[model samples]
Target: MAGIVACVLLSLVTMVHSQVQTAFLEYMQSRMGSVEERIAQWHDHSSRYSSELRDFKNQVLKMLENIEKEREAMRNEVESTNVRVDRLEREVDYLETQNPAPPCVEIDEKLTELQIKKKKNEKYEKLTDCSDTVSQVNAMKILKRFGSSAGLWTKDPIGNSERIYVFDGAANDTFFVFPRMKEFTLSTSTRKAARIKLPFPWIGTGHIVYGGYLYYVRQTEEFQVIKFNLANKTVDDSAVLPIEDQVPVYGLSKHNYIDIVADEEGLWVIYATRENEKNICLAKLDSKNLGIEQMWDTPCPIENAESAFVVCGTLYVVYNTKLPSRSRIQCIFDVSGTISSENVPVVYFPKRYGSHSSMKYNPKDRQIYAWDDGYQIIYKLSMKPKDELH
Candidate 1:
């Protein structure tokens, strides 16, 4: 009886196992079908996309062909226009030759008035008895090897100290101060200059040294002026004037937003504004607090100005070309209304390595110390009396 029960249980277990196997086979087939269906859908989408890609490519090629045709038509039209213009110019020349009429030019009354005024006020147009003109520029000496091509080197225009300050680029924190001008021009070692670090970083090579104080534009959006006391290496004072940084003061010098300069008239700041990008704005800066005492909207356009400096409250803006060549003082603005810009004549700097990065007019020396390329140079001015120009 026990043996018969064991055979029945074994038969029941085998039947259960066969049923499980059959169910698993059906599940696997369903899974395979699902996978096959997804594969087919993917193939169909890929084919459609490929066809669309081919159509897009064909359309692009057609558009390109149309563009080429239009370009060719425009080129031909331009050539025809040029020919017509040449013919018109030749006809005009012939007509002018036959008629021999005086050249008709709309003269500017304002300019004529200015010329008249300049002639009348020629004697009064002076800083002292007469403002000196840059008669000659001498690249007397080149400084030690600097990594950059643009830099600044200036001596104190107020004190009797023979110390010289140097800057390598527009943006820097450390400026080297040499004991004397001779040591600065001749020495190659960095040890010769006492590296003075600033609490606030300086922007642009447009820094000036005067009365034992180093005045520089603080590296900020406002381009605030900072007076760094050389005697103590401490921040003496700072002032922010109404100046825009949207456009640099000079087009060529994109980094020099504000230029601080000192002359016989004391401290001054030169800058450009977004509202008036074409013209330069001048402000008299109080050296004690770097405060704005007076402001002037100059007629001197800032478009081609590369550098500028103040002398006897008169701003001498130096202009340069896109291609580096001889820089010239093309514009002048006198705050006192005593000097006439037209009468002064255009002053040019002698051909050098390149454009000026920094130009500081030393009132004590009555010379302009400029950084041309990487070389330091000085411009000697010939102060001609107004009576002599007559």
Candidate 2:
């Protein structure tokens, strides 16, 4: 019975050990399966994360490539702009070197001859005759008269009676002032006169006395206007007359005559071309620098404009008509630079004496003085009223 009990106990112990072993093995198997599933999920998650990282890197590379392309385009644009600026600078430099100073004189071809002629002939009549004449001795007395005439006269408008100014260029090449009225007498040989010497030997073509100074034009290689101070008796300044391109070069021929006159405004240089193209050019000067301020070219050429003088801004040109007897005609030109078709009647002077005559306008007396050096006489005439003349 004791041996049977020992065997039964050992079997029971064996059975318990087998059961515990089975339970432990089943628990270990379940744990292992869970660990295997976790490992597979981790691998799938890592693959997805790597694919996402690669796509992010590709996007970054594309953005970098776009930025580089934009930078290159901007650089190219800047280089093109720099090249254009350099080219523009070079062009401006070339233009400045090619032409330094341009001409100040401007041309206006719109002005017509008919317009000028109409202005000139507005006052066709009312030009008075040369009714009065004065000898050189009684030259001052002629200024007191009322009638319109042309003559030589001297009156001390400045109240300086100690000396008298004379426009006579015949007795002396230079302008002269006499101390006494008797000195101006052509017949008197004993009377003395003071002469204002010029810088060069000049043939006085035209002259005017203004602001106590004498202004005249001398013909040299070209016409030059010389200003002589009457009080100081010194040549103040001089300038060459600006001739137009159409005008012929200087010569000793008949085409070289230039007439210069001045009114209250300033000086005027009048000249005409020779031959068929008798183009007339008038230039207004700047008194300070003697530069050309304004210029006008006549619409049509004048036939024979021997001498010219300005009065009340009207230009009167003396024309010698050899035909129908030797007589002189006064052609009027308005300020518009138009010649009159209707010839104004003037106190006729012989064509021989016309060359020696100097026409001048006295603003104070409002009369025109024609100094006839050939006859040694002066003719005086009054300017007609604008209403009557026009």
Candidate 3:
């Protein structure tokens, strides 16, 4: 019985040892698998972080390169600006050193005569744009004989049909009219040309309608102002300008310019006297009395001023200056005193080689037509914006 107890106890001890060994072996195998999994996770995380760091470094390097390029471009722009500044300064200094003078008037008489003849021939045609044939046809025949009637001023709009007033300087005593046809039979007046007598020969100055008379200048050193009665179509000697006013000023070298115009107020005369130097004077005279009512002296020493017809009570003087004697500057003055505190002058252009009579303004179209004596061509001026004046 004791021997049987010993064998059973030994078997129990062996079974316990075998169970402990199996449990230890299972625990060691599980720990080894966990350690290997941890190493693999650490390696994967390290590779991801290294790749991200390399991408960030490349982005930073590209940004730095772009900044350097921008800095270099700015430096080049600054250098170019400095060079332009230096070049402009040098050019200004050179211009100041030269200090050029204005050009003198080159009055070539032969050229002037040729230009006058050409203009006369070109404008002489009787462009009678009338609806009636009797008057228009008869008038054109008379105008053609005159060669250049000096009427039908194109300064007016192109399509206007008005009976044009004609004047003859060679026969300074006569004027003619081209009437528009209203009936098949011509008006007795239309068939026969109108005739009038002048105190002198040459109606060179622009004429104006005033006090039922036509006032114009004669081409002579003395007594230039003459008048023709429009109602009678005859010259009235008693209606001539006053003898006292006609007398030239003392020390006056030449008759610079004489312009007459009649408005709602009365007759107005503007003439420049060459009393040592040119001085412009305005005289508002009574059409009948031939007496001056108001006079004002222009501020500018006009070299030569041309008189354009008055419009809307404003008198405009187109003048050119001969400054010290190289560049020709043309000036237009509004003598009406409506635009400014004083008479305002507007500069037009340089080298105006044209005639005063040749310059025509059609206010309806806002176009300026000029007959260029130098180029022998007619030019139409383009409209300019006010801001472009400077």
Q: Which candidate is the best by lDDT?
A: 1
Q: Which one wins by TM-score: 1 or 2?
A: 1
How many steric clashes does model 1 contain?
A: 0
- Model 2 earns a TM-score of 0.49
Per-residue error (Å), model 2, residue 156: 9.4
At residue 86, candidate 2 shows an lDDT of 100
lDDT of 1: 0.79
Better of 2 and 3 by TM-score: 2
Please list the residue runs of candidate 3 whose C-alpha ends up more than 4 Å from where it truly belongs after superposition.
Answer: 1-161, 168-171, 180-200, 218-221, 237-256, 263-266, 320-353, 358-390
Error of 2 at 285 (Å): 3.3
Count of backbone clashes, every candidate in sequence: 0, 12, 8
Which regions in candidate 1 have their CA more than 4 angstroms from the true location? 1-147, 386-390
lDDT accuracy of residue 231 in candidate 1:
94
Per-residue lDDT of 1-390 in model 1, one digit per residue for the tens?
A: 999999999999999999999999999999999999999999999999999999999999999999999999999999999999999999999999898988799989899656543432132222354344443454344455454777888889786899888888877788898899778767877778899889988888888888889888886556688888999988888877655444789988888888889887688888888877888888777788776666677889878789999876678899999898889888888776755667677887888788888888888888888888787877877665433433
Where model 2 places Cα greater than 4 Å from the true spot, the runs are 1-173, 180-182, 244-256, 264-266, 274-279, 299-302, 322-327, 336-356
**Highest-TM-score candidate:** 1
For each candidate, give its TM-score against the true structure. 0.64, 0.49, 0.39
Q: Quantify all predictions' global Cα lDDT against the true fold.
A: 0.79, 0.52, 0.45
